[model samples]
Target: MGKNVNFTLLTMLYLFIYIVASPNSTIDKNALLAFKAQITSNPNKILAKNWSQETPFCNWIWIGITCGKRHQRVRGLNLANMGLGGIIAKEIDGLSFLRSLIISENSFYGFFPDEMGNLSQLQEIEM
Candidate 1:
């Protein structure tokens, strides 16, 4: 009985650790959605067709998104010259692991969100 109890305890501990360490993909997804919400124009309909909750964000690489291999966290967003027009959302800072952001040649207006300063891992940004 004691051995069984010990085995159960160990199993529970491992499950707990897994749950705690697992990546929270929802945060990244919501941030991307927020960015999409602000888009006033998508001439290509790229985002309008995609970027939905039905699909995982990591699967969006074909649309100029990149994710970390280990944690599946968003690492890069390259939407250069897609003719996208919108205001930058402050929620973009929620992408804590974002390293690169490129939106050059687009028609985005409004001041840059101060929340972007929270991206400690960001390494590049192209307006």
Candidate 2:
């Protein structure tokens, strides 16, 4: 009987740790959604069904978005060859954990957003 009580306590501890360790990714989700909204055309309809408020960003079917190691923050965005066209939104700068940005082979126009410089963790950007 004592052993059973000890096991229950351990299990509860584990659950508490898991919940506390998980990072809230509200800002990252909002930023990505903002960028998705700016997309004027999507021939493949990639972001149509996948990127939605009803779904979790991590579970979205977008091939470009990537979550980070510790937290589930936006770590990478690769939109290459997606046939997407429109001006890039500055909201991307809100991805504080972003390390990579790939938007090659698309029809994105206009000057790059100056806010991109705020991405201190950005290591590579393929345009």
Candidate 3:
């Protein structure tokens, strides 16, 4: 009985550590903020007001930022038709676990960043 209790405690401790030390915890937040910074105009002001530093990016009310189930890593970003205009920065590559990207109907002018090739998990992108 004592051994079983010790094993349960150890398992719980490991889970706690894994949750606290998740690698993608803050990377998505930073990447989203960087992306937001590039937007010069937001006619709808969706990202401008919600994607603030005061709240976690996961909790932000932005339309298309999806978080992973286990680790809260960024999984998808679809910033379509928000009337945004800006350069897509290379810093976006920091979202290593990102699976989808859809920035259609927006007016982001500039060559797409080469760093986007680093997103190995990216399965779809419509820009």
Candidate 4:
């Protein structure tokens, strides 16, 4: 009985650690989806056709997304001149590892989300 109790406790500890330490790619994916949700117009259907849960967000490099080599985190986003128009989503800040963002030459309206300031790793932004 004592051995079983100890084993159960140890198993529970490991599961807790795994849940706490594991990186969640969903956060970045959801953030991107939130941004997509705000897009009023995507003339080329680039995002509409590509940005879906069926494909991993890290695999979206062709559509102006860049992911970190070491992890699945988004590092850069270049949505320039794709004829996209919409408000920027406040959830954009969920991309904690984002380093560069370029959305220039587009028709995006509304104030930029204040939540973007939460991106500590952000180094460059062009709007």
Task: Tell me how far the alpha carbon of residue 82 in candidate 1 is from the true structure, in angstroms, after superposition.
Answer: 0.7
Kindly list the per-residue Cα lDDT of model 1 for residues 1-127, writing each as its tens digit: 9999999999999887668635467778889999999999999999988777788778653487899987778999999999999999999988999999999999999998999999999999999
Worst 10 residues of 3 by lDDT: 54-63
Task: TM-score each candidate.
Answer: 0.82, 0.80, 0.83, 0.80
Give Cα distance to truth, residue 85, candidate 3, Å.
Answer: 0.8
lDDT of 1: 0.88
> Could you give candidate 3's per-residue lDDT for residues 4-83 as a string of tens digits?
99999999999987778555667777888898999987898988877877676664365688887676778889888888
Better of 3 and 4 by TM-score: 3
lDDT of each: 0.88, 0.83, 0.84, 0.88
Candidate 1 RMSD computed on C-alpha atoms after optimal superposition onto the true structure: 3.5
Which scores greater on lDDT, model 3 or model 4? 4
Structural RMSD, model 4: 4.8
